[model samples]
Target: MLTIEQATYDAIVAHAKRDHPDEACGIVAGPEGSDRPERFVEMVNAAGSPTFYEFDSTDLLHLYQEMDRADEEPVVIYHSHTATEAYPSRTDIGLAMEPNAHYVLVSTREHGNNDGPVEFRSYRIVEGEVTEEPVSVVDAFPR
Candidate 1:
């Protein structure tokens, strides 16, 4: 299961909604080896396609360097799907390089910028295999 704070979840949903029609992509970084997602880092979708999402290479490189300097690792990698369900596509599965990161997919098909519920789901994609996971949203992580 993927446990997340409500604010983090809301931020991700908002980003997805804001980038509707063009997939939004981002990552939440936390201390290396820590599964907790504590920092939100919205990214540019280089593909900028309704059906596909890709992190800009330059931005990705910079993010990696920054994370390294901060002793952080991406705990959650997320993207939005404008017209499909919150499931990983073949390409997405193929691009799963972070075996330890939670892959999140948010679908804005139902509402499409309207004030309606969206499909937010999480998964584990490792070695081309996709496994859907449960998500638990909490006000905050207990101290």
Candidate 2:
């Protein structure tokens, strides 16, 4: 299961809704080897396509460098589906490079930019295999 803070979850949903019609993509970074997702970093969708999303090469490089300096690693890699369910596509499966990261998919098809709830799902993709995981939202992380 992927446990996340309520505020972080809300922010991700907001970002997805804000980028409706174009898939939104970003990541949450935490200390290396730690599964905690404590920092949210919103990223631009280089592809800017409703059916696809990509991070700008330079931006991706910079993000990795910055994370390295902070001794952080991406704990969550997320994207939104504008027209489909919150499930990984073949393309997504092929692009799963972080075996230890939680892959989050949010579908804005049902609600679009409305106030209605979206379909939020998480999965673990490793070596072309996708395994669904449960999500737990909490007020905050315990020390």
Compare the candidates by lDDT and give the number of the best one.
2
Q: Give the TM-score of candidate 1.
A: 0.97
Clashes (candidate 2): 0
Q: What TM-score does candidate 2 get on C-alpha atoms?
A: 0.99
> lDDT of candidate 2?
0.97
What digit string (tens of lDDT, one per residue) describes model 1 on residues 55-126?
Answer: 999999999999999999999999999999999999999999999999999999999877989999999998
Which stretches in model 1 have alpha-carbon errors above 4 Å?
A: none
**Candidate 2 at residue 137, lDDT?**
100
Candidate 2 clash pair list: none
Estimated TM-score per prediction?
Answer: 0.97, 0.99
Q: Please, what are the lDDT tens digits per residue for candidate 2 over residues 20-86?
A: 9899999999999989999999999999899999999999999999999999999999999999999
